[model samples]
Target: MRFVLAPSVLALSALGLAASPALAAQEFYVGEPVMKEGLQIVPNYLTGIQMSAHVPGMEMGKDAIHLEADVHAGKDEAHSLAEDTWIPYLTIKYQITKKGSPLYHKSGVLAAMVAKDGLHYANGVRMDGPGTYRLTYVISPPKLYRHVDKASGVPDWWKPIKAAWTFQYPSKSK
Candidate 1:
């Protein structure tokens, strides 16, 4: 009446157990990824933190939520950027509003950051509590000057792009 697991299975089980803590540390609610102007934008959120210690120029506060944006190059062959590459040096601004409210609950520019998940823009915001809310992101092109040869230059960056999503706070998984 005894069961035995294969060596490979045991190894996989040990690896999963070892990685669970890092994977379960943060539970996030992710919005649908939007594609526009040759770029893909994804919005997500998790519990907030006192990030001043880690990020330069970030204020210290116990914000309600840590919002993030993942911007990547779209699958467009015309552009020089490789598909799914993280696009850096761009300005991203976020605004949050309750679904039924006319006024914005919070709004600010997100700082570029690197985390376990990779490069993205993120910021903290204090929420009024759990509810349905609308999140909007306005992305501006990278401002760095690039020296390009006429034959090798890529197409110009897209104009300011806006993407929005509505998500419920205190998501079911969280």
Candidate 2:
């Protein structure tokens, strides 16, 4: 029997570890459409460098898609922090405005991908060499959203919280 673990399921299974906010910095994209959905496989911060586009200033939109290859982790401990000690991670970022999904709150998932473990899940497929992985994802509430600030109660740019995948690299250490 085959089962697909949806992104929400995967997020709950890992107890939010795979997509832990503590594991990564929250990415906010401005000028994103009120509603957006798509797949993106971005380079983990550990890959010897940060993708220029991922930098804070780069403009992202609802239709933006990126496919990154040549994956190799950096040695710096801080940069590797994003992997959450997990390597071969594919970082997928998406944003949604509050107008997209009604009743949208932080109680649900943001983004996720599935491995052999199941749909919208974590871990690797035990494959060798750099392989292309299809990142199937889902943004809950089916709409756009944004986070309100604590100090000022000011909601920043409309965005769906970022979700990351740390596909354990083929390492015996892990």
Candidate 3:
């Protein structure tokens, strides 16, 4: 006997495959510094800073994104790391853009790092349900000195960067 598949069934199957974890694995990318909010946010790779992120496996009621970062003096470091020098403040701003969903745009500041010196990590950023999301990482460095922008009043720093990645969040509709 021969079997035939219906269009609806085919479409559903394709969707299921697309939502598989293998296709939605963790994503990583490097960001280049840009002037924004009057600070230089350099990428870990370039500024002797190390950063990484991972998407936790989707569970019955929980899915999160974990991140870690570390900073050290690079070859020709820009800022002074002398003993008495003030520690440069580091912060991360994240935004999630959902393609076709009623969910409104979501963004917030990550909790302060538990470890202060260099190494930094967080539990993870939570998502609203599951679907395709565009994640943007905006790293902000300490403002030791600023170059004021006459037009916008926003100052510029040594090095600021932005990074982006797109990934699908598996839904629980299997």
Candidate 4:
């Protein structure tokens, strides 16, 4: 009985070890969600993911982190958009600055992408090193052409909004 139990436990341990890397790829929130201009924006980061086989962008690397903006409609929104519904056709740009250091700065526009979780804007950024950094996302309303009748027209989209947060690199939580 002892020999059989030992083998079972060893197999389970091996399985757990094998699964650790997958679990490590999970995302972690950078800060609390920010609600503004009838929108809720949540910032998160995780291990860099492969965007394309030939694209020169964020990919799994020692210093790469995948940044994401989970943009959705907020409660109290006057527009007909449902709360928590993912907003589409918006432009999102990200800027990263190393806290208290003027030497390191990077900025780029996030591309719209869909994952198993949902639609969001994201980009891959390579960090200088482990340290506290500030991430700011500038969001702009959709620019798609739409005809609005007088009876069905809603208010114009909100102005570009900025959401910012500071977080530690090599996120301790992950």
> Which structure among the candidates has the greatest TM-score?
4
Q: Pick the candidate with the highest lDDT.
A: 4
- After superposing candidate 2, which stretches have Cα over 4 Å from the reference? 1-122, 127-132, 139-151, 156-174
Worst 10 residues of 2 by lDDT: 26-35
Q: Write the per-residue lDDT of candidate 1 for residues 64-154, one digit (tens) a residue.
A: 6677898898899345779989988999988889876666477889988776668888877777667898888999998866546788766
* Pairs of residues at least 3 apart in sequence or in different chains that clash in candidate 3: 32-161, 33-160, 33-161, 34-160, 41-159, 41-160, 44-49
Alpha-carbon shift of residue 42 in model 4 (angstroms): 0.7
Per-residue CA lDDT of candidate 4, range 1-174, in tens?
Answer: 001224555576678853323423468769999989888999998673545442346445667787889988988776678998888898998999997789889898888887667787887888889889999999989876554788876777878999899998877883
TM-score, per-candidate, Cα-based: 0.75, 0.17, 0.41, 0.80
Residue 3 of candidate 2: its Cα lDDT? 33
Query: Candidate 3 regions off by >4 Å?
Result: 1-61, 67-76, 80-88, 114-118, 121-123, 143-156, 170-174
Q: Which regions of candidate 1 deviate over 4 angstroms? A: 1-24, 48-63, 101-104
Q: How close is candidate 4 to the true structure, as a TM-score?
A: 0.80
Tens-digit lDDT track of model 3 for 3-64: 23456656766788533223222333334443343333332211112123322331122344
Candidate 4 clash pair list: none
Q: lDDT for every model?
A: 0.72, 0.28, 0.43, 0.77
Candidate 3 yields a Cα-based lDDT of 0.43
